[model samples]
Target: MSLKSERRGIHVDQSELLCKKGCGYYGNSAWQGYCSKCWREEYQKARQKQIQEDWELAERLQREEEAAAYGSTAQAPPGAQPLTFSKFEEKKTNEKSRKVTTVKKFFGASRPGAKKVLGGKRRGDAPEAKSGSPSISRQVSLETDRVSKDFVEFLKPFQKPGQDLYKQCKIFLEHMHHKRELSIEEQSEYAQDFYQSVAEKLQTRWKVSPEKVEKAMDQVEKYVMTRLYKYVFCPETTEDEKKDLAVQRRIRALHWVTPQMLCVPVNEEIPEVSDVVVKAITDIIEMDSKRVPREKLCCVTSCSKHIFTAIRTSKEEPASADDFLPTLIYIVLKGNPPRLQSNLQYITRFCNPSRLMSGEDGYYFTNLCCAVAFIEKLDAQSLNLSQEEFDRYMSGQSGPSSSTSSSSLLPRGRESSCPEGSALALVRHNLEAVGQLSRRQERVEREARRLERDLIEWTEGLGREVRGLVQRCPLRLHPGTPASGTPAAPAVAIDSDNLEDPRLPPPLQPQVYAG
Candidate 1:
């Protein structure tokens, strides 16, 4: 055949002119020269079918593996939609970025600075720093049982069995105090609002019921009333205020007394504390008066004395020294002393040893004995100097009877106010002779003189400290304004003293209690 005819004609025997697989199909005369129409169709169909089957089998295996791992074939909800930018879109974005990176790598391979210019990570995938606030997981941990233990420990002293409601009550009171300065009437209104808020907080934050919150608040109020009755000066309500006309009473009693405004409670007798505790407390007062702020020192000293008196005369013994010690220290460290002085003075009538001793079944006798012993001990300790030195000290000091500005703050009036004919005055005179050692008739006079000197000198020193403290931290009732540098006590108007019953008998002798 001619060469041109041979190129165009089919050659059956020549494999090069036929399909490469020799499938009895004519070759296409293309680059691979593999197969012709019919045979190429069958071959393509078989390969495509295999590929399709492989893809199906892989998908089936993936589903089975997922079901095995999760123990269920979880599916999206009926109306659930896919995310706007899903993994499929992300995959396309990643592939396109890779292609761009590959092309850039080839083009920039010769340039040393190109690597430095390129981003280390894809911009969209870069990590961001977390915010400064604590995570939700951490926030949730505060309300857990782990934190309850700490709350319980704090409120243990104030808690009743199976409940620590007083902690919540304290929160309410403290919030009111800290919510900016409010006037007396304003404070009352704010306190009522805060009280309600505390109830809600207990119900929500503490998981307490509304009923429990109300009950706890009531208990807290009663406890507060009891405390105000004994310690708070210028309390919101009192027997004296109650006796006034309703309109006047509301106006006067609108004031809110804070925990810091401790006073000897009205119409309440001083409760007795232990002699040991009283002695220790007094020692602290004497030693730290200068180191502690004048206001705190005075308030704590006053509180300690009041507690001592209360423990000495109260029919019931204090729960424990521990119960009062922490609280006492806190008051000493933080109490407002100026307000405390007013409180002490207001209850002077109830604090008379003579009255307590004569009152039916009162423990005033035991109280007086303890107090006398304490005073004697203190007096003996004070007389450590030579007789001449003691005499010199005595000569320079004024007696408690003197009402000089320096000695005015002392609680001396309570003793001196006893009538001349009263047994209380006689007892005082005898107690004044306690430290004497009588030798002969003349020696007795000398001993009495020494005892008197010692008593006067020691008391004078104490009065001086009190006066200094008051000067440094002036009480609210002081007439003149405090010095520019001095810390001023919180101010409240002093109500006029309620007159005592005219027929009431004079306090019996403190000496009678000693007997």
Candidate 2:
């Protein structure tokens, strides 16, 4: 190719500078396409074959990248290193999936921790079975509460006619005339239960049915309402007393007497109390001037004063030990201040002022508060204060402080308690120091009820499952299509202990306060 230039020994054209032997022929250049005098014809053929194969592969790869980048039927591995793929693609996909799942969860999907209810198949996820599920047990406890309370108020009067006043109802019923062999005091017993009283009164000339007595009670109720409108309701009180009286009226809406049938005259004059209750209350109240140090003392000041007045009536002597709990409760629940103050002042002026004052610190107020509070705990705990009953009691007073009192407080024990004053000598146990033991009976009862219900359900469920299994597998052989090699036996499960714990109840989940 460089023949003319080489022969003439002259300047060659720049295009003619192909290489030779590691040098340009004139001012030499190395070969680009081939080394000088390169050897085999077969190598050249092989190099050509490799080039064609590599070019085809490169094209195929390019096509694959394009297919991955654009829409294509071929699915890439999730971790495939496609040329066009990026790190964010996988992350973005995952995030979108999570958000969609979350949205589904809130809008009635069965997801954990969702505020709304969700449908699900798992037995544990069934609405009532779920832990911390919404419940109306507390509400049920309230409506049925009347049964328990009425039991307390009325049962004793009938069972123990120690009071001549209540026993007189029998006398009045036997004889049509008001004048009976029994004393006027006997008339009092009829008033003990409004239901009983209605029964006794309606049958003055005839035998009364419980239904008829109920009807009479309905009429008496309206009549009492009219009387309240005319008499007690019309009378003026201090603004606060008016409010309390309204509440007491509500508490006694249908009836006004305690089981004792002692007429708590509406706005009855409060007897002066320089007694133990008053002293205790005064001390408790004075403990903290600013905060009302409510925890330290057993009773509130108002409750304490009322309690002392209730326990020590001017018309009556000091309340017996039997009278203490009820007297305290009545004072706390329904007592008037002015009447109590008037009574207290009367006692101080007429009776010995020194006697009125229990101690120098008391002036009788502090003692009153302590005594009343001591008695309230007593009522919370009785041989009768079953778990269901105490829970019902605690629920009625469900505030923060009330919660603490329910949990941390101890019941008074039998040692400090006086023996029951009934004709029967039932031993009155002292309240536990911490109050928990006192309410144990109630807790146990509630547990028993729950267990009874659960046992019935579990027994029925187990019976059905067992019966089905036994019927289905008559021979206890392979129940399904048998394996060729291994003849599988019908599996029979025998798990007996499926009982749920009565203790450690699921947390009482609160209902959201939606306006």
Candidate 3:
């Protein structure tokens, strides 16, 4: 119905203006013919509720689909009722019926009235098996089996001296599969330990010579190392995931020791080198220098130094080779050191510095630091020059322009006017004596202070005990009171012969003054 508004004198349709929910309120244009506030809110609530219901329905349908797809419906209690998937169950039943029907069809076709074929071949024209010729597929399978057997036999020598070869191979392969989880050194140590244990067992059980056992151990280690290197780094093998997994899981190498693993970094900050580590390595190289080439050792040492320096900037463990790869690549690419640049390809291909420096325990870095400290101590022992003078000498900073000779840094005194060599010796001796005296004085002072503190504590403890005893005594011996049941107090006595007693001091003596 059209109504006239008195305020504006405008005609409006009452039915069109009214709220659709019958709220008895005029609808606003903003609400699209519904009450603006309440109807909009109710509409939003309805939409949200519908959306929630749809989402829940979708999730339930997905779960049911997954359950049906996997074909296992026993989800709840020990003996819950099976859920029904009518279409799926029907399909399965139809498949069974179809298979049965096909079998029956085959039997029916074999009836007496049906056309008979010779030897199960249609029309007696099918290809006949030739007795003398093997199929290509059969030949390939036979060849593969033969190769595998031959390979196993080839690896027999690499097994521990007296253990079952097959069993040892299995264990080694399993170890290789998990070896990447540990650092290269740890893996080497483990392999070495295994070799040692096996060798010892064989030595005791088989009465094998120590030298023979060592030789066997070396062969096994070498085989393992070569095999591991090939398996891990080979281009054709490494990319094939299935082959790689199989190799890691089942392939065993005897034990390989590359030059990189054995290389030790040089001391840069100290004049004296580590005698023990350097000497051991030198001895090995001298004994069998061909096995560990000097060039390879040098390259390994250089690469190790670079990696150690690179990682020192960050305390976080490097997650991959990429972390330091860029820096090393830059160094090689820059070509400032022409030799290193020329040999960069060979170094990268053969020597993996990342593997060497990746020890979780930081043994390589620790060893390098120890070597440097040892060298520094040795230089201090032998060199007469001060640290600054030594530094200048090493850096060529004390050339013709510099007035300070190595001996000029010697202690200045009447001894300074002596001959250079003699003065240096004298100064060194004096410094050494002074250092020793200072150390000895510090120790003596410390001992004296400790002794004093102990004496004080002991005296205080004794004083407390004496005071306690005197306070607890009941023999007061007062002149005014008669001594009843209590025994008479002893008279104070002094022993002149024992004047050295610790308790003889007048201040420490207990008073027996009558009140």
**Stretches > 4 Å off in candidate 3:** 1-170, 228-373, 376-381, 399-515
lDDT of 1: 0.37
How many residue pairs clash per model? 13, 48, 8
- The C-alpha lDDT values of all candidates are 0.37, 0.35, 0.40
Predict model 3's lDDT versus the native.
0.40
In candidate 2, how many clashes are counted?
48
Predicted model with the maximum TM-score: 3
Q: Model 1 TM-score?
A: 0.18
> Could you give me the TM-score of model 2 versus the true structure?
0.16
lDDT of 2 by residue, 74-136 (tens): 465676654434533454455445533322222121423412224423222234424242454
Report the number of the highest-lDDT candidate: 3
What is the alpha-carbon RMSD of candidate 1 to the true structure?
A: 44.0
Return whichever of 1 and 3 wins on TM-score: 3
Candidate 1 lDDT score at position 325: 30
